[model samples]
Target chain A: MTKKIKETSNSETVVKTEEGKTLDQTVSALSSDAALFNREITQFNVEAETKKQRTATIVKNIFVYTFLTLCAIAAFLPFYWMIISSFKTEAEYRESIPTFFPRTFQWKNYSVVLSQTGAGASFGRILLNTLVVGLLSTTLGLIVIIITAYALARINFKGKNFLFALMLATMMIPGEMYTITNYITVSKWQWNDTFTILIVPFLVSVYYIYLLRNNFMQIPNSLYQAAKVDGLSDMGYLIKVMIPLTAPTLVSISLLKFIGTWNSYIWPRLVNIPDWRMISNWVTSGFTDSAGILGGSTSEALNTLKMAAVCMVSLPLFLLFIFCRKYIMHGVSKSGTKG
Target chain B: MPDKKDTLPQNDVNDVAGVEENVSNDAPQQPQAVKPSLAQKTKQAFADLGKKIKGVFVKDQVALIRDAGNTVITAEMLAGPQLSRKEKFSRFLHSQSGWLFVLPAVLLMCIFTFYPIINAFVGSFKQNYQATTGRFDGFGFENFVRVLKGDTGTGGATFLQCLVNTLVFTLVSVPLSTLIALLISVALNSIKPLQKAYQTVLFLPYLTNSLAMGAVFATFFTIIGTKSNPETPGLVNLALQAFGIAPIDWMGIGSPTWELGAISIPWAKYIVVIVYEVWSGLPFKILILFSALQSVNKQYYDAAKIDGASRSTILWKITAPMISPMISYLLITGIMGGMKQYSAIVGLFGEQMGIDYDMGTMVGYIYRYIEDGYTGYAFAGSLMLFAIIMVITAISNRISKKRVTY
Candidate 1:
């Protein structure tokens, strides 16, 4: 019987057909591999449709759509208000009767905020500072994360498990616990007003290391061995094989890191002077008509210019969201770690 | 042989004995078809016993010496109970690349993460600690006392008050937003035509700069006109005016308050905070819960339908429990994130957190102390915040266990 089974190639449950191996288990409406995503996810009331049941489903559908529409509006309202207010004049912004649409559009607010060359309020200089810090930190941090994750994933060494556990344990402690001491340490080194303070301290993020390690692990070890057999060194295998394979995860990490640096407020605010602080820091300073580009008391804080500043800060992230929604959402929902 | 001799006649003994010897010899070499006599079997057992006895009493040199013909394995090749220090070090170097790979991360973490953790604990205990000078008066719990008592000399919002605000906000908003997210995700899951559109729109807030969003939200409810000289009371009040209710000072200094003993609740101001929290926090929870809802097996719904269960019954009894683990995960993380909330308050109410810093959260309190050069108090406050997170996490875990049915 065993010999006959082996000869027939029927010992395994999966049947080899012309198409491919036939599935052993029964496939439900969405249980098939291809259908999991493309098919609608609703597990509806699939009972035989009587007129009453049909009407019930229709009513339920209506309620669901209305609720969703209302939620979407609530979710989109702030963004709309921010954009519209950015175009409004300062006097119009504070109008007791707010205008949904700007009475007169203005590109003047953006130009006014951009022209300020004051100490902390220098828009061009701060943007340059943010870009420099975001780039350097992301690149340096990526290298550190990659190497650490690769070693943890593929390399066999003494104390590897212990080292990983220790790293993960740090995540349990809130960052605020140790950040106060870091302030003293940085200040003691007199690293204030420099980019080193911003880039170096936050370079080693344990969460990213853990995430990349998991991603690296998903690429099978046989590939690593195959690379080695092909006369590739370990570093070469990592660069040519592991890195390419985990490109999606790397893109997600890089994007998040950049967004993190862009939106970072606390560390940059604490350790560096405002002149060297990040983009979010620049936005927090009340954007007034200090230039008097709009008709107002020059020193008075204007919501229009503030909105314009916020618009400028938020645009890049918005663009990133549109282009890379899949990668971003996957990264977020998988780990739920933001920066 | 002696038994045979006794049993057989003297004349026939030699021939019978020869035949018996041949049969025994044949039996020893042959298969189980030829059975062994008892005497022959006894002799073979004695031989094996001798070998076993010899093995116990004396050193078996054969174990040390490997077999030359077949695969060679010796006892000496095995690891002993103890390893030499030199051997350990050499083995460490054998995996040198692995060590080198993690070296940068371990070094930076040692410097910035691990060392600072130790220093915060030390600094928190030191009395009259000065940051610039790196000096301390002595070691005591005075910093903890002053921090808890609101006597750190820099005053606006006390640590206790901040703790209360954080708890109320977290307890109220996290669950409220979670329920709202659950409802939205369920609704989103059951839709077909506008699924992608609704999903894209709802997820727009996920990438928002909270600071910018906060300013926009602040405009929505911020009565632009002064209380004395009344004008249009923002969009929210405008809607309320349609219902014939008067506008209130929601975010201004003149905002109404009801003092419950030491702790005060600014209901109107809180409404703004809670509203923003729900709005800003919805996308992430929806993303998480929606994905979870998608993967829930249709079998459960089918089973519930066969049982004649109502829609709400299936939701509460079947669907909710199916994703209870994800819900609990969301809860723990949401509460923890809420405790560390500083920037959202800063965005809504400026760096001072509110007018006179009345809206300070726990992290805001810690940063305030840190900014004021009261490093000791900052350390103590941060430690307290850490402890609170640990305790709350434990409680949430306990609550989570009750929800995890299977």
Candidate 2:
């Protein structure tokens, strides 16, 4: 079954390229009287077949659309619930029968969350901390990755292939394996609860390096050779030629890395206490802390506040995904297929 | 092409001549190039110190000294004369100076990833490792033995239970999610319009923060009202109740009745995790398979139509095998990712899993050890996980080699 699929898919590409060459032959043969008569008969058969196929298609479409619409709702409902629940007041949220929509919009909940402080930092402060961590880590990581990828891709060096293979092998190891020792190392270095602890350890991502390296490899090596022949230094060539050539990929890597840092929870939870927690850490920890000035210390009150915080935290990422949907999808698809 | 290459070679020759002339012109300003600089002297001192430290471990001082001498000889050749084999070798090394570009990243990886991995392996053998003094009482296989025996000498579920949880989670979720994603992708591909809108909506879960969304999921499954009345059930329960089914405590904290072997399988928690995993994992898998399906030739379907093949036959025979590689890719990655599950569960059920480590995964189990200062056992657990991942990856790789085609 699989082999047949491969052949059919492969033959499709072949047919496209062969179509132009075979067009004249088919047209000329169709012009003959006997061929025309045979073609007319086949055309009638084709019309009938197409009509039958059309009904089948309509039936299929109905089923497909119904299934897809149901799945889409299942996908979208949670997010819709989150947004709507964020606007629900504590009393409404705690009602015996849950309301699909808020009885009355509670704009004050957002302001209350913003005003509340936990882990020695306000919500806005945690957001800023997250932004700073994301920006710094991504920027530093890109700089390191770009240079490494350029060297691996374009430059001839001793043991370059071996180094690349070694890096690829590291990717196979579960990242949890490194967490224990890294925590110890960071603690030994007295880097706990600091941005340095968050940003530094994760600055070198072999996956991003591999992705950018593949992109750099796609650029013609002749360009590097030409630049060298023109007396351009290696660094000069990398910055002038390669970087600009792979800007879209670099942007994709940066944006994805930024989102990764923003969404990071476990590492921040491990190393940073409440004082230095990122926005994600705050969303999980801050709402449950009784010291926060948001509302009364009840599960019902906290649920509303928690939903509001979740909506606030997720809003920026949602907007970013909406705006840069193409790049994000392209990056993921490129990595998935290439791997 | 010949004429263009000929002109280009001439230009290259002129450029080389220009470079040579410039080097010769600048040669007078650097007359003492053969002499080592202060930086070179410091670097050599550091290398000598490194050799001394390494001698304690390596016992091959002669080879180390010989390598050091060879480096000095190469440096001298680069600075002094350009007529011998040494000079040629030195030029080769100079041309391969791109190592300098990758040096920073390599150094960071060595310290943060490679060194820690080795340290973890070493530390796993150490008993009662003292973090403050950076010492251990002794080294043995005791930690690994304890981990395997599910006897951490602590009052909790054994490491075996955690391993089972992880394996069961991965085993169930990976294939289920991949199958759903494949079906969804196929259905989405068959449609003509609103495909993008459907894709955008379906991909929403992927963009969500797992921890936050997990909290939202916890809310979705929260059953309100007393046990008898069950008046205000969560959304999921409400939907189930519409069909006359009773509400379930989805996090499994309230009451778990299902049992598998010695452990009670918290079906509610398992279901919630699997649902979340499938929903979140769908976007990437669907994206991959959909693209693969779209790229399949329409002529195949037409051919099948002429042969009077049913839609199911066409889909199964012609579509599934074509996207087998993508399916395999998602499966392997999904399993690997599922085994490493941690924060999402924590987000759903908090730090303690189901009344005290009942739902603890392998990673969560390791984390609990870490929190309790059982660093040795934690490292041991990590090594076991590493081994499992390697074996699974190898087996899957071999299977894919035979099963998946370009």
| Candidate number with greatest lDDT | 1
Q: Which structure among the candidates has the greatest TM-score?
A: 1
DockQ of 1: 0.47
Docking quality tier of model 1: acceptable
lDDT of 1 by residue, B108-218 (tens): 999899999988888899999999998899899999999888886776888888998888888899999999999999999998998999999999999878777787788
The regions of model 2 sitting more than 4 angstroms off are A1-55, A286-301, A336-339, B1-93
Q: What is the lDDT of residue B145 in candidate 2?
A: 93
RMSD of 1: 14.7
In model 2, residue pairs whose N, Cα or C atoms come closer than 3 Å (at least 3 residues apart or on different chains), thus clashing, are none
Could you tell me which 10 consecutive residues in candidate 2 chain A have the lowest summed lDDT? A22-31
lDDT (C-alpha, whole model) for all candidates:
0.80, 0.76
